[model samples]
Target: MSQPAAATNAFLVATQRALDYAGFAPPSPGATCVLVFDSTLWNTHIASVHGLLNAVEQARAMRFRFERDREPYAVGHAVWRIVLAACLNVPISAVPLVSTASGQPHLPGTRWVTSLSHSGSWVAIAVGEADCIGVDIERSPSQMNLSALMPRFCTPAECVQLSGLPTPLRETRLLALWTRKEALLKAFGTGLNEDPASMAAAENTIVAAPASCGRTAVCHVRDLDLPASLVGALAVPAGAMSHRLYWLDRCSNDVYGCNSAETSIRSN
Candidate 1:
């Protein structure tokens, strides 16, 4: 086989092995599946995965000035396509993933809704049959200027709640709150274009759409239990009662570089 063809075959085989290792399952009615993967796992296979991206995604990945930014973007989108393909039972290239003007991705003409977020080394993808869905993952920074950001994103009440905590606790809580609000905004499809302060950050609470949204919506936001260094959240229309989370990391065997015995599936 030609070098390019051989690389493509290797990626395809690896993707299948990963899915099989995870015992991957599609999201069902009333539930969403959030897959979190370490993008670095694909570092050695960048060429193989880059071939999986569409022209637009390829151009966007190339636009990144540094390999640090470029590699993750390619790996994230490639894995996203793989997951969606498995869910729809189609070839990876056949998944009709498209982005809105604001860059939130979705499956055009399909029942499945998708939202993607990445932070530090991790990339998260949420998929389900909800009217709308959003997922966000953020790595906690060692330091931040909380005073400068809190007012911009937090409501008066939220600010009060966060301020009452000690500095360390406050910073941690704030990051968690930020993820929830971002997820909710993405689910509303307005992203940060809408005033984040207009929505509260309380978990499992119904969030009303901001006046600028020009429509009424009740979104449910929940905190995701992730590794200590990372905070994540999911937002879906109220109808979606729960979600399942799967961590996709490299296994020790390292041949396929996709499976992980440590992979965990959590439902809530």
Candidate 2:
């Protein structure tokens, strides 16, 4: 776990408000909670590293080619351990992990759905009972020029919204759409194989039954609140639709609450 709580608390509070502004509902108990962290936190909780890795034998036995890449690799692994430990209310050493040929990390025999994403010093993890889930955090300070990328990812309506927004909002709206599409893609585990703009999922609220599941499959996608410099989104299978944002820096504490005034939903 991250050693200090003060910084983590402040970051989480700001992120919680960001989530509220993006039309996120007060986290439901059954939906998994999303936890955000800064990459720098990977160094502070150094003392717990060994135990955290050993708890999951698969992680301990892993191999890497370059020594320089080890730290960042370990950081991602450690974040997963820390988040899983916090969620299970258990010690980091007790968490177990399994690797699959598909490369998506799994929790041995458990049904928990998880997704991890990091960009520009920030890392986020979303866990829950949903059969499939994806979470993404994007830092927009250095994001690409809006005009160059929108045609590749945005639906016609999204593009119209982009053109209609005030100059100050153009970039922000673009990032929001990108993050939402990325989250949806991650949830499907389909990577870039399918067109994000054509997913046909509702803008932030609709859960559609995929044709493959005999019209019974469903996935929910929506935006997340984060610091002004960052944007985020979450996706979950309909089986588990509740969600809450959490701060897990110390591995055990509720740093934010859902008492903020709810904002009206924004239409894309």
Candidate 3:
């Protein structure tokens, strides 16, 4: 084969391999698929993944000012495109993802609602058929002054509940609650522009929507099962729906090799 043809063929093979490793199956109708991956695992393929991004994403990646931040942004967005392509049944490059004024990413004319979040080295993406959807993953901090933050984001009732817990448990629950609130706000496409303390994120229950969100609508928050160091949550408009979780990781023996493990999380 000619040299250029050979390179193109190799690229195609590698792309298929990565997709297979990610287990890029479409979410079941009316369900969301949440994929969490360590962006650091894609470090070796940064150049290749960077190539998958569009101009806007490329410019955004360039503005990161630090390599550590840039790599994950590139890798995360590349994986996001891969997931979106699978959902839309299109090639990765064809996914027309755009960000809203508040910075929530979505497909312009599609019914699919999407959200992305990254913390430390982990990135999480959510795709589903819903009125709106949001997902967030956060690495628990080793130490933080919860007392200084609670009043800013926690509701009065949440403060009372958390105040009764032991220190360690309170810290963990605090992060979980933060993720839930973030996810809910992102789903509304208002982000932190609305006060996070306005609504309480009680698990498995419908919480009153913020002023930016329609007064009649409510949000349902559910915590996600993640590795001990990380906490995650998903939010959607109040209703019945399902979600599937997948973990994408690199093989220990080969930096270029990839694999995925499916994690089943029961609904609340």
Candidate 4:
């Protein structure tokens, strides 16, 4: 298995190839793809800024992309812009991504559903035909204290179940559960602002939130086998069974490189 950095690179290459296979090309294959990293920059905020910028630059359209001219609220926005461009053929600077009153993002004049997530240095985004979808990626072997975070994030039963597992196993289990819930919350547009302790994941299923939250959206969870270093989950309102996966790579020459797809979306 590839280490985290290598695996992420592989995914980038894979995504770019998938886009090519899908018949979209913003630039030549041999050109460099841009992936900017600032050693002095903090990971938390810069992730979103770079993610959005990269997505726009890759698509060669910035109309819908977030304004890189200002500070970013979350790296997820950057990923969202790129995913939108790749899937919808729109520009990152496009004004369609205006937020709803509830903070849900919407594309103007369209019903496309979009979601974004970032873990460590990598981010993933998913877009679908008007179906509520949430995507999340978490860097595993997390530096956080599982014991303390588990109680705060896990359900009581989950805590009990985790306690019975070996330390290594327990950590993986806990992270998976956490990623699932985080995905759900992102779908809700609440993210970590919601109390994780109130959320629960059992049997790879997220228990429906209380009726007070308005309507219950259909939820589906899948473990994306990207790398052991990262845990990714997808939450979509129960909908269709088709999705295509792609890998993307950025070179320094203001051009993006595409790697052919190694996996295709299958019926769930």
Per residue, candidate 3 scores C-alpha lDDT tens digits across 1-268 of 8755564445445545655766667777667778887888666556666567899999999999888888889878887887798888888778989998878887987878899999867899999877788899898763567656999999899899898888888888898888898998888888899998887887666766677865556667788878898989988767736677777666664323434434333335
Which portions of model 1 show Cα errors greater than 4 Å? 255-268
Candidate 1 lDDT, 161-230, residue by residue in tens: 7887888888888888889999988888898898888778787677777776667776778888788978
After superposition, which runs of candidate 4 have C-alpha atoms over 4 Å from their true positions?
1-18, 21-79, 89-91, 100-103, 203-207, 250-268
**Between 1 and 2, whose TM-score is larger?**
1
Superposition TM-score, candidate 4 onto the true structure: 0.65
Cα error of candidate 3 at position 171, Å: 1.0
Model 1 score (lDDT):
0.80
Q: Where does the lowest 10-residue lDDT sum fall in candidate 1?
A: 258-267
Give candidate 2's error at residue 194 in angstroms: 2.3
Q: What is the lDDT of candidate 4?
A: 0.54
Task: Give all candidates' CA lDDT scores.
Answer: 0.80, 0.60, 0.78, 0.54
Error of 3 at 151 (Å): 0.3
Best by lDDT: 1
RMSD of each: 3.1, 7.7, 3.2, 10.3
lDDT of 2 by residue, 1-268 (tens): 4554554444344433434443343233456777676645454433334434553432543554553344444555565665576556566567765654445556766657678887755778777655677788888754588666767887787777678777657887777777777777767666566676665444576455333323344577777766687788887765563566654243224322332222222233
Expressed as tens digits, the lDDT of each residue in 1-268 for candidate 4 is 4455454444344434434544443322211111221111223234224443444343443343544422222433544455566555666556367666666666767656666655545656666674466666767887877776777887787777788888888888778777778767767666566777776655345346434346666565555555567777666554444343444444433334444322222323
Clashes of each: 0, 5, 0, 25
